[model samples]
Target: MSVAFIDSHMVEKFVENSQAFDKCIEERFNMLDMNQDGVLSRDELQNDANDSSFVELALQSKEEVDSLYDVLFEKFDTEKKGGLNRNEFGLLMKEVMLAKAHGFGETPVCVIFQEDSLLRRVV
Candidate 1:
């Protein structure tokens, strides 16, 4: 019923192995490749429909998805220049997978950036 519980259950159902997980990552990479240039940009990531699919899987709504993106774009904008590099995007994906494994429900995967940071502070 909780995000964590949903995340764990989904991971169990969908991410049974490393290959499966890699496939998910690859799918995400392809989605984020908005320009088809084989690279990802902050605008592409922020506006990606593929990114939305993960949130939809996690069962979040459009407004929630938007808010989540706002937070991720803010944090991953490491240079405060307003965008994420591939490395930052990869880190975000890693955290999402970890959260899924840990059974965290999805407000949105992007929300994980803020939630994880806050959770770490609390812990």
Candidate 2:
């Protein structure tokens, strides 16, 4: 294949992957929203806290949800809006994925992003 054609194909693939990633994030966030309000409240996050596996991946345990809420607010709620919308959730998840890929397996959601900003930024 010609170099220009390969470049075009690569761009198309990148766009497709990005869209898929966004859709996945949206689906996950919507599931967590619980109120269909397009943002995550403390109560909504409590749902995940109640789920043992989810809490394990997110913070620590259901008992630590209060602190988990604070960490999420500080890290993901970049606008200081008191709740996280889909975009923020998606961005935060992107950082989470990077953290996982970088040998930080099951550390905790808060710790994953707070220690680094480079992984969260898209460029």
Candidate 3:
């Protein structure tokens, strides 16, 4: 893991760069896919969530985190197919990155991004 200071401007620039953003998201999706299948199942998503310690989720209890992941998985599974395709995963990343950008505002915050994490790629 490595630490870096990230602000909204940095995140916005990364998001605006469509090619880089898409590439990073695609790589992350593939990493989380686990089974080499084109689609990501709920179990795969849950496992990824459980494996990663997200900054925002640090304060939440296990039950709360599980519930949150369920909601997030449902949001990403837009087709109601019980799995997330590459396109759906891309959309999910877009929203998540945008949300982080907005949440950061003008302040730079210290963050420890895990190796292979999307935030690390953004930086």
| True lDDT of residue 74, candidate 1 | 78
Evaluate all candidate structures by whole-model CA lDDT and list the values in order: 0.55, 0.58, 0.83
Q: Between candidates 1 and 2, which one is better according to TM-score?
A: 2
lDDT of 1 by residue, 2-120 (tens): 13213344554454455655555666677668777655665686565444344562576768767887888777757665656556666676676566557555432322332322122
Q: Looking at model 2, which ten-residue stretch has the lowest summed lDDT?
A: 1-10
Model 2, residue 56: what's the lDDT? 60
lDDT tens digits, residues 20-105, model 2?
A: 66766766687788889888876776776565334364655555667767887899998898888888887777765554444533
Model 3 misplaced stretches (Cα beyond 4 Å): 55-63
Identify the superior model by lDDT, candidate 2 or candidate 3. Answer: 3
lDDT of 3 by residue, 50-96 (tens): 65656556678888887976787777888888889999988888898
Separately for all candidates shown, the number of backbone clashes (residues 3 or more apart, or on different chains) is 6, 0, 0
| Candidate number achieving the greatest lDDT relative to the actual structure | 3
TM-score of 2: 0.60
* lDDT at position 21, candidate 3: 90
Q: Supply candidate 1's per-residue lDDT for 25.
A: 62
